[model samples]
Structures are given as structure tokens and as C-alpha cells.
Target chain A: MSRHTIALAQINPALGDLERNLAVHEKTAEEAIARGARLVVFPELSLTGYFLKDIVSSVALPLTSPFLGRLRDLSRRIDLIVGLVEETPERLFYNAAIYLSLGEIIHVHRKVYLPTYGIFDEQRYLAEGGRIRTFRSGIGRSAILICEDMWHPSAACVASLDGMDVLISPSSSPGRGGLEEGKTFANARAWETINRAYAQLFTCYVLYANRVGYEDGACFWGGSEVIAPSGDTVAKAEYVSEAILVADIDHAEVRRARMANPLLRDERIDVTLQELERIKREGAR
Target chain B: MIDLSLNCDLLRRVLIGFIVNEVRKAGFSRVVVGLSGGVDSSLSAFLGAEALGAENVWALLMPYRTSSPESQEHAELVVKQLGIQSDVIEITPMVDAYFERFPEADQVRRGNKMARERMTILFDHSAKLKALVLGTSNKTELLLGYGTLYGDMASAINPLGDLYKTQVRQLARHMGVPEAIVQKAPSADLWAGQTDEGELGFTYEQVDQILYLMVDRRYELSDLLEAGFDERFVRAAFAKVQASQYKRRLPLIAKVSSRTIDRDFRYPRDWGK
Candidate 1:
């Protein structure tokens, strides 16, 4: 059984101040490494804060952008997953997560779901991603899902089908709604429900890292956590406070839960693909 | 059975933290709240004091001539209980002097004048004390457009804007606010016996339940009707929310250019702060 210790760096990112945000990432990463974490994950857009409308284009960077070199260098000792606005050569932007390991960029996952409703306006500023895949990292086979992508079950399904041992979901969701007992925020409740369900259904360890602090009027609730494969919340950070949560994940449990549930084994992808294609062809007519 | 219950301990910490951070971020350390002796204003005072210490939170009691005497007593009770600095300013002279020219001024005009007059006093003292005026309007009053424009609607920040009236009452109980103020009939106290719900033609408890479903839960008109709301009441409530849309937004700018303020050119209010 391979055991990996992960850190959720739930730090507050100041809007449009790239220098300050980078400093925060460096400081938090150092702290996580001191705590014996092998893999560290940050919230969505950890480099640039959420609610960046016009500033999205101003702060967008490519994979080779020099600003990310600091993080790439830090990954030499410990692997890190950090979120930022990715700009293409043609000038399109994406809410993206870059996975760095051993002083190099290994994978980049652009957010597939751009939520436009309520407080979110990502659709106005970002291009949607088209791909979802799991890749080999220093910590083994891992999949990365940016903020809203986790809300869509297909993104998780695709990742699970790709044979992932662990799922990393980075988010910048705001605290909202009336308070309920055992849950201080409504959005937090939704997050708990979905993450637990995903862990149990996919039979994989789930790592969720949410940002904290206020941007404009929206308050990001930073209750980041790691969930076990049996739908149990193994560790959770404090709400509305910036703190790094470290938890040791047992990779053997993924195999244990998968054998017990056999949910992934029973999936019928060929039938699903054929039916989806047929529906698309016939419904368009 | 509406899920209006709150974890008051957590709410207190977050709200106080929010107030302190927001105020400090904006380069202010103190706050001013109008003490109306109502659940809304009293709750704002408590939050302000909890956020920025008692010395930093100042209470202003601006009473008109026809204002209820019990209102003044209750306001005093909050001030004494919180051990915060307070002053009583009589708004009757300013309002009477203005209304003398218009003998035909009705209750609406008089009420608007009183509200605006009280706000003027609050702002003047806010400048003197170097504090920002904390708003006291709740979500129900804001959605219904029950507040006067450019009057009590203006503030540096509003902590209670998201909580409904009933929820405010629930929170008031949790915050240890005086039960006398919480149980009393909610009144703007513009005239001798003006009550908020009496003029609105519906109880706050009833309206808050409907709003919880319609606004928060995103229930449709039919859904509200199915949930036992009267047809006429639902229609009126929905109409008010739609009609008061302008109150919830920035003033409309007539755009001659490609990018105008509040149109194509928009930025967060706390952009630099």
C-alpha cells in the first residue's frame, strides 16, 4: 500500500495583486513541506483571485509564463497543484489548474464548466475546456478538476473511467444561504454532499481545497478537506479561515472500495457512447 | 418548519470578522448606527459593537416629534447594555421647518422627509466621529422597497441586508437583544402610531415565509400558491420585488459612448480597497 501525505493550502488570494498572491503561495507551500506533505493543492485561481471580470485578460498567463517558474521550482522538493488564468496564443482565456512535479509542468486541466448563474460570471470571461483525463504524477495516477467542473458528474465520470487513484478538486465557492445546524453555510453543505458522494461512487480518495476570505461582497468559505473512499470526511479545515490541512491517504483503500462496490467494473461505456451518438443524430433532426 | 434556524455562535464570529475586515480594509476603524429601537437597528448596533469595540461603535438616536416614547427608551436600553457612546438628536425641528411651507404634505411626504433628515444627521455625526454609517434595512424591507430612496437606504455597509425580517428576529434572540424590542410591533415611527406591517397589509412573519420560498428557494408563482400562499398576496409580493428592481441597482446612465459607467464599464465597488 502506497501512502501519500497531501496538503490543502486554503489561503486568501488578493484580487489582481500577482506579487502578493505568489508570495502567499510560496509561504504556504513552505509551511506544507515543513508539515511533511508530499503533494500540495491550492484553491481555484489561487494565483489570481475570483471575481476577476476585466482583469481576467490582464492577469492570464501561459504554461511557460515566467510567473509560474517560482512554483515550478518549488515543486522540485514537493509536487504542487495551483490554479491560474491560462491565456492561449490566440488570446482566449481559461480557468485552469497546472500540475507541477519534479521542477516541470506535467499537466494542465482547464475548467470544463463555466457557471454564469448567481454570483459566478466565468462564462463571460473564459473559454470552456473540452477534455478531462487522468495522468501519472509523482504521487501516482491523479486527476485534477477545477471549481465548477466538479459540479458536473461527467467530468468525474471521465476521470474515474481513466483509472485514477485520487481525485483533486480545487474550488473558490462563496459562503451563502441561511445557516443550518451542523452546517454554517448552504454552499458548504452542497460541497460536503457532492464530495462525499463522489468519493463513494468513484471508489477513490477525494481531495477538495477551497479558498477563504472576502472578495467584493462574496465570502469564500475555506473548509477544505480530504474524504475517504467509504464516504467519510477524514479531515476538514476551519470555515472562513485560511489554514493548510494535512492528511495521509492510503492508496490501497481505493482498491479495497472498488472491490467491495464494483461500481466502475459494471459501467457500460460502449452502450452509453452509442446511445449518446444516436440521440445527438436523431434529436437534431 | 422553514429552515430559518441559525448557528448563532458561528454567525456572530463570521459577521464580526466580516465587519472588522471590511471596515479596516476600507481604511476605517469605527462605525455609526442609527438606533431606531427596532430589531433591525438594534441588531446592527450589537454587530457593530462586537466588530469594532464599544468605543469604536457610536449610536445615534434621532427622534421626530411624533415618534413613540417607548422607542427612545428601548434605544437607550441598547446603548446602556452595550456600554457604547450615544447621543439623542431631535429631528422634529428640521422636519417641521421644512414641512411648514407645504401644509398639504401628506404622510408619505412627511415620512420621506423624516427619514432623509435623520440620515443627514447620521452622516454629519459619522464625519465628526470618523465612522461609517452602518445600514439597518433587512432583506424584506429592501426587496419590498419599503425604505425611502436616498434616505435610510444609504450606508457604508449593511450587515443585515441578507437576513429576512423573521430571521432578524431569530438572530435578535440569539444575540441577547432585549426581548422588549424584539417582541414589539415593528414601526418606522415616522408618525404617532405608524407600524410597518400595518401599512404593508401583511405580517413580516407571513411575508418572510413567502420570500424564503420565492426568492431563496426559487419557487415559481404556482409553487408558492401550492405552498398555501394566497393568490392576491403572492401576486402583490412578486410584483413588488419586480417593481423595486431599480432600488437594488446603480442609477441608470444614459450612454452616448461605447463604454459608459454601470454599463459596458463596470468594476467592483471595493476595487482598490
Candidate 2:
């Protein structure tokens, strides 16, 4: 379908409380379904709260866990994207987002970048994912980039090259660098710019789901939004408040944008790959 | 000079949310603040009242015999303005009774004792009221180690810990803190005729800018000098921050085990909340 309604579940998940967070997810998904949403998106680490330093092991869940069964059942009614700490059978953990539809796991995108600088210690606890790939969802071809993955342009470039119609970014971004006039944080402004640039450049829909509420003095600013292929914000939630932001997106817009700009169509993947290989060989030397 | 201006409206919302979420997540509905009538404490009380309803916030006005009467009156002004529950618990007896045994104690020792006495009262009331002790120390005082460790520095949660003194005053003014309290010279009220600027040997404005450059901007000593900051003042301010480093942290434990308390036993304060 070209036209569909999407909901961004801008919720505040309880820290390390998997049961409570699961209930929240179920309730928010039911509300979105009632509101005529075809798909619901949640922020990164929606099941387990961000900054889960040592408690990461306790909250990690395998794909076969009952929690995924419950979410998979919920997705039968409305396609759902939920974030969790995925545990492999070998005991390795990754920050992952799973797409569920028709009571089945459509795709699981492990977070590629684990930020380890100021206010982030993800690399110390969770193993990083190795792949950047897109999958077909109920809506269209899509890719998931958890938080820091969107910060790197190459990740989005690969997703766009893989022919993704929607770039889904789930973030637990902390609000910082307070500006005086705009009533927005520095991180929010940067995210908005990135979302718009990616939408316009890749000629695709950009769905950004960011959580709200304070955790240990770091306040995650919600401001979840949807950007059209025209680089226009279709809908936006309030900052620092929990909200389920819904917006209508049409794939026809992506087709029209690509036809008008032709930026993605006139791309040079061969030249790009050749230059990257040359740069890698030089670095190895 | 680096611009220290903050979007007061956004900051007020963010701080109010922080207070509400941090308090409720920790499983508490009420908070008690040691109101000293200073801008920092007053701002904390105001934010606390706004975050958790006025009825949920309790302000304690603890004054010593030597403390200025205006301190109590100013604190009362805040109580009356916000209409939060308050009590005037004079620390004179608690502080003076202890000092009587050591009459030769200097002002700093007596002041520290009074601060601890107030802390004791706040904690006792925290137990009685089942409320968290809201901290009021601003970043400037915290970085300078100007606060009494384990005394005024002790609290469950602090919303103003990141704001500098100038930023505190800016926010206080924006929040409509009574002009008298906002414009008044900042003092710990530990002794009569003493002000923080007088004790620190420089203005908060000067030190706040220097600290912003040093701490926030991560400017080097050379960068500070290149930015036209006074060498001696910057050196002195940096020394104060270095000397009082211990006050800003928990007591260091000798690491004997593989997983030390602070070194490897890493967990956020809001774990499992």
C-alpha cells in the first residue's frame, strides 16, 4: 500500500523493569491501533531503559523468550517495532530492534554503533552488530538504525543504497545544549536536521521515535517526528513529554521526490566502492 | 566572556520534570528542602514546590544565633509565597551546645558543625516525613568545593547541581524570586557580616566565567590566558577546584577486590526503578 498511518510511541520505559515496560508497550500499541495506525514504532532500548550499566545482563532477552511471543501476538493486529537487549544462545548481547508482523518476526536489526563517550557506556556492556541491511515490512522496504547508527552518514547511505523506502530511527537521546529562542535542545535540532537531510537526500520517509522522561538526571527529550520525502515534518510530539505521535505517509511522495530530484537514481556506487577499497588498502599499508 | 545565558523557560520545564521523575521513580511523593533564603536554596524550594505540589514540599528554616534575621524573614517570604509547609528550627542550641565544649573553635569549624547539625535535622525530618532531602548546592559552589562535605552537600537528589551561580541568579530572576533575595549578596549565613565573594576574594561573575571556560568548554590554561582571563585569578580558581576535589566525590575505598565499589561495581543510581 502507498498510504499508511504510522505511530511513534514516545514513551518512558521504567529502568530495568521488563514486565512494566512490556505492559507499557502493549498498552501503547493498543492505543495506536485504536487510533487507526498501521504501524507503531518505539525508541531504542524501549524494553530496557538506557544507561543500564551493569543491569544489562539481567534484562537481556533471547528471541524465543515469552516477551517476544507477547509482542509478536500484538503485532498481528498492528505491525510493531520494539527495541530490546537481544541475547544470543552463545551469551553475547546486542542492542537490537525487532520488527514483528502477522505474529512472526519480520526482521531484527542489531544496533551497529554503541556510543561510549560522554554520558554513554554502551560499548563496555553490549556487543556491536556487524551488518547494515534493509528488510521488507508490512508498509514497504525499511531499515532500522538505533540511536548512534543514524549519527554516522555511511549507515544511512548503505540503507538508502539497499533501496529502503523508510528509514526508522529509534533513539533515547538526552536533551542538552539549551538554546534561548527556539525552545529546543541542541540534540533535537541536530536530529531534525539529520532527519530532513536524509529524507530529502534518500527520497524516503523518515520516522524518528525518541523517548521522554528523566533517568538519573539525564532527561530524554521525546520530540518524536515523521518527515516526508519533501523534507517537511509531517508530525512532531512535544519535547520532554510522553506522546504517541501519528502521521500519514504515502510512498507516492517518495516516487515523486526521486523523480524530481533524481539524486539517488543518478548515484555512482561503483566509483564510491572503488574509492573506498583504495582508501582501505592505503590505510592497511 | 563566554555567554552563560540559559533558556530559563526550557530549563524550568526540564528541571521540574527531572524533580518529578527522579522523586517518583525513587518511590517518594514528597521532598524536604533546607531553605536558607539564599538564591540557590530558594530556587530549589520553588522548583520542588512546582514539581511536587506545594503541599508535598516542606521547607525547613534552620538559623543559628549569629545568623541574620533577614535570612529567616527571607526564607519565610518564600514559604508564604509558595504556601508550602515550613518550620523554623533554630540550630543555635544544637550548634552552640556542641561548640561550648570547644570554645576555641574557629568560624570555619563552627560553621561546618552548624551545617552538619542542619543536615542531621533534615535527615531526621526526612524520616519523619518520608521525604527526600532536595539538594540546593549550585555547580559553582560544588566545583569550588565551597560547600561543607557530608553536611550541606548531602542530599537524595539535586536539580541545581549543574547550573553555575550566575546561571542560578539568572534562573532565579526569571522565576520571579523576590528581588530582595535575587539581588542580595550571596552568603552561606555561617557568620555575620560575611559574604561568599568576600570570602572567595573574587566575584562569582569572574569565577563563573573562568569556570565555564575551564570546566564546560574544557579550555586549557593557555587558552584561558589567550582569552584575556587574569593569570593569577585563573590559577587561584583552578587551585581551589583542585584542592577541594575530594569534596565532590564519595569517600575513596582502597580497591582490594576485582570488582571495587565505585571502580567496577558500576550501576546507575536509578537502577531497577
DockQ of each: 0.54, 0.73
Mind sharing the TM-score for model 1? 0.95
Model 1 sits at an interface RMSD, in angstroms, of 1.6
The prediction achieving the highest lDDT against the true structure is: 2
Per-residue lDDT of B113-181 in model 1, one digit per residue for the tens? 989998898899888988989999999999999998888998888888988898788888888899999
> Model 1: what is its DockQ?
0.54
Q: Model 2: runs farther than 4 Å from truth?
A: A179-183
Question: How well does candidate 2 score on lDDT at residue B51?
Answer: 93
lDDT of 1 by residue, A129-217 (tens): 88898999866788999878889998899899998878999999988885855557877888888999999999998899999877776
Candidate number with greatest TM-score: 2
lDDT of 1 at A244: 96
Q: TM-score for model 2?
A: 0.98
TM-score of chain B of each: 0.97, 0.99
Q: Go through the candidates in order and give each one's C-alpha lDDT.
A: 0.89, 0.93
Candidate 2 iRMS, in Å?
A: 1.6
Model 1, docking class: medium
